[model samples]
Target: MTKEENEKRLAYLKSIVARLPEKPGSYQFYDDEHTIIYVGKAKSLKSRVSSYFHTEVDRFKTKVLVSKIHDISYTVVNTEEDALLLENSLIKKYNPRYNVLLKDGKTYPSICITNEPFPRIFKTRTINKKWGTYYGPYSHAASMYAVLDLINKLYKPRTCRQPMTKEGVKAGKYQTCLEYHIKNCLGPCVARQSFEDYQKNIAQAREILKGNTRQILRDMRAEMEQLAEELRFEEAEEVKRKYLLIDSFVSKSEVVSHTIDNVDVFSITNDEKVAYVNYIHVSNGSINQSFTFEYKKRLNETEQELLQLGIIEMRERFNSHSKEIVVPFEPDMELENVVFTVPQRGDKKTLLDLSLMNGKQYKFDRLKQAEKLNPEQKQVRLMKELQEKLGLPKLPYQIECFDNSNISGTDAVAACVVFKSMKPSKKDYKKYNIKTVVGPDDYASMKEVVHRRYSRLLEEEQPLPDLIIADGGKGQMGVIREVIQDELNLDIPIAGLAKNDRHRTNELLYGFPPMSVQLKTDSELFHVLTQIQDEVHRFAITFHREKRSKRALESELDSIKGIGPKTRDGLLNALKSVKKISEANLDTLTDLIGAAKAQIVYDYFHPENTTGES
Candidate 1:
């Protein structure tokens, strides 16, 4: 904080930066804790590194960055453009706080038709030539599912797992699945459809993706007219519906421009250490969709060079179908059939310029996001507040909470929710049935649940949670402590959430004297704990309800004699529910339960059972 301290830090940074080569390269800055604070690439390492030392630059953000710099490092590269590429890659790797980050890590869905002997189409998250032709990384799984549903409805490709074969068809080895009766599949496995015809359908699908929908529609319209003329009204109607769907899709792609048949547009913007690259796919002149990729490392290359590198990398990883690449920045790649143009004038130039503006807007949006505390930070803050409120040794960033739920001492189930860095880890959430507990005693249930969760965690040698919360008051906490200390021999801080009369989250009880500490409603830390508590409670109750339902159903059947486990299972499978079985006629009962058992069931549920007969 003093001048001397500042000077020492600057000197340390200078020493590190001085060792960096003058060539194009990527650089990283570390904080006092040796944590990566920023990442970047430079066209000229010397010029870019030196700029940080200039105090008179009048940039508020840059000044803030310089003040935080404790050390610097760089990796020299062959070209400015390559430096840009490296910067993007490293930024993604480190994900420094100051960088523009693409927070959503959701994988897109792609339609993949297998390259096997059967060549069936399926939805997948990954694509490779070994599988088959992959259509897209569609933004949503539902879209891929919709396409799958439509394909099944129209093409009737086999939904069954059986292998397709001419011999199987000749021998009638396979029965047509329900999909064929429902008119959703072509029953290829039975060889009802020809391979050549199936290939034609595949070709048509490819043509649709290629923006040749007009031709397909035209062909379908002609076919439909011909069918109608031949008095095949139902078949003609189906073809008409297909044509309408295609037309609707084409109309929705209104942004398609005749001039720009196939191209990808890219743009880039930067703060001192962070950079954002925004990409738009302009196929046939329509801006169908756009995405943003962020880089945390500083770039030594100019904005233009970085944009070019991003285009190449993006195309390599995705967009194999794209023919031309368009950008406002000058690209350095010599990709065949790829045109890198910086439009100086005209409508095409205007569109490119607009894309760059859009990139800047995206950069600004990221800046706003960086200003807000991220999920990890929010978790940490929540843990700190929870620690302070609960009066603990350290922030309970890794807290595990438990809850048990049941109906009338039956179908008792427990749940454990783990919070890492104050955030609920939905993936780590676990559910358990109270295998040993026979009654409504919550304390025993809590003991069983905590024991099972921690027993496995210890056996696996996993990291222990900083805090453990039980749903009940002192009784539950005591059960947890006995199991943890005496049984598990672990010394984890534990607490209990005692609810008020309104069934709302209330006082916190930990070590004796039970502290009642309230958390700020606006704090991120409070929200995190509340989320974990809610999640654990929800999970426990859900399991309990399901178990209760199953037990109730089982009990109903257990009351009937001559109905052992297998017979009971068969009755349930056939009738699906107790209500259905209760209302069944002798004929239906005979069909499912057999003649001998049917008479017994009828007598059991009839007047004789009213007096306590089995």
Candidate 2:
């Protein structure tokens, strides 16, 4: 919380790290709040734990984590593998912020075939290996559901969660379900279909799941012919329909080649901060599986290094151990007896192209996700860009821009529109009705608003803005500097925006004696300045128009005598207009108020007439 406190905590953490053993282990770094901020594996506990304190430990996240470290803890392990295991366990247990955990709050869906008597085939995210046979980690729910739909259509499998046993069915303990009634399932529990018969369909379903559909279809065709030869027309018809359904579904899948079996394909793309990897698992000539994931590059990691990391991470996550992997380019990583192919042309190249395309799409999707989750970071980036472009000493995280608006001299008003983190804070916007400044004096009006703004902020102990923007050239900037620096002795940086003859934003000006600060018209800094200028101008003009309208309305009503504020408001409210009060009949006017007062109001508008009502 304070510099001394932070220094004391850092010293404590360094002391703890100094005592670590030379053994392989896992280490934890705790923040000032005594919460674990990082979990790491170490081949040597002392060396790894002390690395954070060394002068050259320069990864952005590592540096931040080290700065917050209040304590260090370690668990010694027997081997490097054991260290890795323990580190993973601690990271999962604590979910440390600095760990490279790939979580987007979404897990690929899978189809599980329960290892029970009536083996229910269903789509699920959770899998207990002892309970079922899992077919996939499908990248999208729609794809998994599509396969599930095909399986349901082909096999008529039971989908209910009801437990079943041979004895239970024999004793009539099991009842027919809605699945059977809708024909989505054959009533296997009721013995409507024999166990062997159901297993036959399931065996074929396994082949389909493995992308061996052509072989399964051939077997189905042969069985159908045999059934037809035996004159079992209905049975043959059912097999024929299933064969056709599986054929149609298989046709939709992209097929590279019949020889492209039991292979994994990888593509990697990298920006400065992160790497995106796309994976495809090929089985029996078809793309059986696909997924895209990203990794944050810690230390300017190269594409080859990132690809190696991603390959290991993804294969372990997806549980793929294919002997051969096809990649866009060969990585330096060596896996025992695993071949990596970089295809120059043909279907393999096409497949590589597809995977690379997926990588690009994954990168784009992550940018969209980052935009949604960390809106403040977007504004921070803009502010930093603006500061660098203008060579400001600090980022203008809080900016207050002023605009003075008036029509000649009447309704002179100034508005202070605040931009916090490059976003408009309408609640912080202040409107100043001109005082101590007469007529349309932009410089004086600017000076008065700047003085009042900072003076009140100082009085209330509210934080002042990092920068001030005046909506004019050196003239307005000079006056604001007089108030903020010369008068209040505040050192806040002040800038100005000058307009061309058409009163549109032209260029930015800043300094003690303001001059043009050149910035590209298409740049983010220019866009931000334009937005601030437009917003403050709009806010000032809107306030000025409102003040002018209210004054005009009041002055118009003031011309009529005996029409006090109460009667004026009543006329506006009841008649719904001040204009309609003159058109009312004498009785109407009398009904609104007493006839005596109404006569004065009615007679004021029609002074030439000798009214009988009066």
Candidate 3:
């Protein structure tokens, strides 16, 4: 915004803030279009709103937000808790641009138990309150199916859609379908099963859904024993089957310990633009529900604020009433009856770690999905990572790596490979022969190459690479810095790839003294670094081999007095190898080349024959 316009907006916001009551409330900021762009809850509306206009408001995003605001509105509340609830509801309703965006779970399926006389249980994507109690909007369909399967095996609830009232059942309005014939149902539509018995089974299933399996297991075991004592072997065997099913299902759940019951565990992690929160609801020592979700950040929200919002959302969604909550850190808000524990050790700590792992995994999966959609995002992310790791002021969009290669200093050569956006740019790759430096003096060769490369770039006013990497350890980095910084007085960031005993890239070295920056060997960042190292090495080696081969060929042919370029080309074209040219007879050589050049070549190879003729 223009300076005058910005000052005008600040003055308008300050006047509104002066009039705001000092009570706990939620405030909304409107843009020039009169649309709400931000909503926040505060203990004192006047104090919070006034702080935004203070001169000390230095955060760039916050300044931008304040500059956009054309108006302010607020709602007075009785307490901070009420303001929090009001803020949450308003955020959900309006979804302001500057509020944390919660990804909705309406698309996920929930296990709903119908509210009919014979409540049918099934998976559904919709939630209707008149349709009975909904257990979950399950993120993983497989886990939901597992629970449904267990319920079907144990309770044998009716799966039909028929609405059977008491009068309808008595008048035989509904007929038994194939479910009854297949013994999947007890023909409840025809009243073959007592109402009381069906209701009891549904009650048991509800308990199981609530993750109260231990009590159900005990009751089933007791009933099984009673049936056996009464000489009802078939009924007892059926009860045994159900008891075993519940037991197996419970065993599969992650159980922290029986001592720790009815607790909620939460973990939070974030990237530049998004925050991920993982929730695990433990009931009766078993993990009843596990979910990981992300919040798209609009402002620079802290981990504490996101975690508190996540705790409220998860608790409300799961209807958790656990008195104890385990978190990685203490949140900013407080609940009347709830206690937040930041466990340092033991099972609770392990549970916290498990939640953190899920959060990180969810973040990773989301990143992968985004990168797949826009492949360039992956490159940009890697470049940012490289920049942050090397402490460079800017993203290393263009990186150049240098390497020198020689075999006993015969054909000394250096190669500089260019990488633009973390990929090799073969067009920009350069090869240089050692001129001022002789022998296999790697340091001197590198100095000459570095000096020549950048001096020309500067002279031509071309863009220099954001980062320059030496394909060696600290010593090589020092050499490049001297040429680039000390001599040329250019301020290019330089780094080096340090190798281990097995001749593998181990870590990156950076800075003046060249401190090691360790990178995971399996990470994509490390792969990119190694790729740059390998490309420079490969280019230098290939160039060295070509130059050496050309020198060897020149020494053999060009050394002869009469073997001009044309005559040598003619001889090489006919005889592919130098050995073949040496072994050829005069007649063959004369036929391939002219008689004059052929005689010189033959005499050179057959010195003994020339001596005898003389």
| Number of the top-ranking candidate, with lDDT as the measure | 3
Sliding window of 10 residues with minimal summed lDDT for model 2: 99-108
Predict model 3's lDDT versus the native.
Answer: 0.89
* Residue range 1-614, candidate 1, lDDT tens digits: 89999888888777776776778888888888888888776778878888888767776666777788787888888876577667778766888766545433237666777775656777777767786877666553554565566555556555566766666666878788788888777766566777677777777776664456667877999999999999999989988887877677667654545677666777787765666776766655565445566655432435655565467556654554566666765655445555576667865666676677777877766555654746454445456667777778877767788888877787778888887775567898888878898889888888887888889999899889998887777778788899999998998987777777988765667675456557554555445556677888788888877777888899889988888988888989998998888778778889987998987776666654545538
Q: Best to worst by lDDT, what's the order?
A: 3, 2, 1
lDDT by residue (1-614, candidate 2, tens digit) is 78898778778877888789999888887876889887777679998788778888777766776777777788998876567657666765797777665553146677888898878888788868999888777766677787888988988888778888778878889888887898877898899988888888888888787777878888889999999999999999999999989888877887878888888899988776777888988877888788887777544556775676567766766677789999988875456678899999987888899999988887877776886799877787788777976688888889999988998877899998999989999999999998988787888888888888899999999999988888888888888888987899998998888988998788888886777887877766689888999999899999999898777767777778778888877777778655788777677888888798788878876677745764
Residue by residue across 195-216, what tens digits does model 3's lDDT show? 8889999999999888889889
Q: List the candidate 1 regions with Cα displacement exceeding 4 Å.
A: 1-9, 67-71, 105-156, 160-175, 195-200, 203-207, 210-252, 266-279, 284-317, 320-614
Given candidate 1, what's the lDDT at residue 416?
84
Highest TM-score model number: 3
Evaluate model 1: give its TM-score. Answer: 0.44
The estimated TM-scores of all candidates read 0.44, 0.62, 0.81
Total clashing residue pairs per candidate? 22, 0, 0
Q: Name the lDDT value of residue 85 in candidate 1.
A: 64
- Cα-based lDDT for every prediction: 0.72, 0.81, 0.89
